[model samples]
Structures are given as C-alpha cells and as structure tokens.
Target: MFTLSDMWTFFLAFFLTLPLVTLVHEAGHVLAARAFGAKIKFTLGAGKTLFKIGPLEVKRLYFMDGWCQYESLKYDKLWVHIFIYISGSLSNLAVILVINFLIYQGTLPVHIFFYQFVYFSVYFIFFSLFPFKTGEGQPSDGLAIYEVIKYGKKADPID
Candidate 1:
C-alpha cells in the first residue's frame, strides 16, 4: 500500500527530474545540430513564453498547437539530418551512463536517491528516442530515420 507522503514524493521527484532531463537532451540536439551547421531555437515548457530570443516568427500549429521554428539552409546530405536526430537520445544515454558509473563508484547514495535518478534518466532516454508525433504526420527522429533507411527515397529499398 502507498501513502500520501509516498505519492507526494513521487510527484515531486518526477516534476523536478523531467525538466532537467529534457533540457540536457535538447541541449544535446542543439549542440550537435550547431556542430553540424544547423540553426537553432529555444523554448520552455508547453505554455506561452515567459520570454523568447532571436526573431519571433510564428510556425504552424501541430499536435501541440504551435512550436517555435528555427530555419536553417536545408542540407541535402542525409548524414547531417541523422546526426541532429540522434544527438538528443545519445545525450540522455550519456547521462544514464554517468549516473550509473557514479552509483557504482559509491559517489551517490545507493537507495532512494539513486533509484529515483536512475528511473528518471531511463524514462527520459526512452522518450527522446520515441517522441510523440505531431499532427503533421512525421514520426520522431529515431522512427523517421528508420523509415528513411528502410524505404530509401521512394518505396524502393536501397541497394
């Protein structure tokens, strides 16, 4: 049986951890994209902005109603796109690895703290790899990459 305190702890831990995890994951994407010569934009949470930076241009609404768009010169090469897609998930995995290493090396507590951190990191990694699709009918990065590779440019398989 669970008590109110336990429920409160879970909620508090989840809310605290989710944003941190998301920021790190998104940072990974932003950094990798920039490294690969792509432009970037930033946003916070799901609500109207507390503030924004750069040019404030409106993008079309999708699953979430709207997203701030950052435009970059289109890259013809698939590798750049792949890198941008995979970087966020890779960053989350890196966090998981670092946390696990710290726990193993006795740098972090072994009980509740360790458990919650590990749980949050793992869930964050999963979500980054398989984000909810927008109403535009595009799959998440990982899924899109899989489809692109599987079907080639058309319905034909790549030789």
Candidate 2:
C-alpha cells in the first residue's frame, strides 16, 4: 500500500534526482559546444542570474529548465550541431554503459543510485533523442537532429 511517507520519499527523490540529471544533461551540451569553439551563452534555469562564469550562467531557479545558446549554430556543419545536440544524452548513456562495464569487472557496488542513474539515463536519453516538443514548443535535441538530417542547416529550431 502507498502511504504518505512513501509519497514524500518519492517527491524528495524526484527533486534530488531531477537537478542532478539536468545538470549533467546540460553539461553535455556545454562541453560539446566548447569543443566546437562556438561562443555560448548557456543557462540552466530561469529567473535572474545567481552567478556567471564567462559564457555560463546559473539562474536562481536553476533546476527546472536549461538551454545552451551559441551563435552560428544554425550555420554549423551537420556533425557539429549533432554533437552539440546529442552530447548530453550520449553522456548519460556513456555513464550507464561504464557502470555496467564496472559491474561486469567485479568493481563498484550496485546500489539504488546505480539503478536510478540507469533508469533516468535511458528515460532521458529516449525522450531527448525523440522528435518532440515541450508544451512551450521547445524542440527536443532529437527533433533538432532530425530536422538537420531531413532539411539540412536551415532546419535549426534554435538560433
């Protein structure tokens, strides 16, 4: 039977897990953008800026939303844009794979976080790699990639 305590635990876990997942996911784009030498203005959340570091900005409400902005991204090569878009999901998948490898090698304990990590990795990766938009019309990374694949550079939903 589900109880109040279980509901509370679930909510608590959601908050904690969501933020970490979002950070890592966005970090994937940031890293890939940097690798492409694209000038970026990345933010992970809304509201006023809580902190700024060169091209990165952390917002006060920095847990619900995140996006990486870069100029000429719409004009970049297909591979470059693809790298920037899929890097986050790819990172999550990579982490899950590495963990599985470690488990196979008899190292690293299997625990709740491990399961949570794998679950969320596959969940987010699937959604992020799917061609869909949020209620606000923000396209998923997969949608962006599909656009590029089908229509070429002008298909960039972001600018």
RMSD of each: 6.6, 3.0
Candidate 1, residues 45-154, lDDT tens digits: the string is 65445455563222221112222222352553566666666777788788878888988898876776556666766775675467466566645666655655665421
How well is each residue in 1-159 modelled by candidate 2, as lDDT tens digits?
A: 878767765664566666677778888887887786766777777889999988778888876677776655534688788778899898887878898998788797886666776787788889888899878787789988887788774333334
lDDT of model 2 at residue 9? 56
CA lDDT scores, all candidates in order: 0.57, 0.76
Q: Model 1, stretches more than 4 Å misplaced?
A: 53-76, 111-113, 135-138, 147-159
Compare the candidates by lDDT and give the number of the best one: 2
Which 10-residue window in model 2 sums to the lowest lDDT?
Answer: 150-159
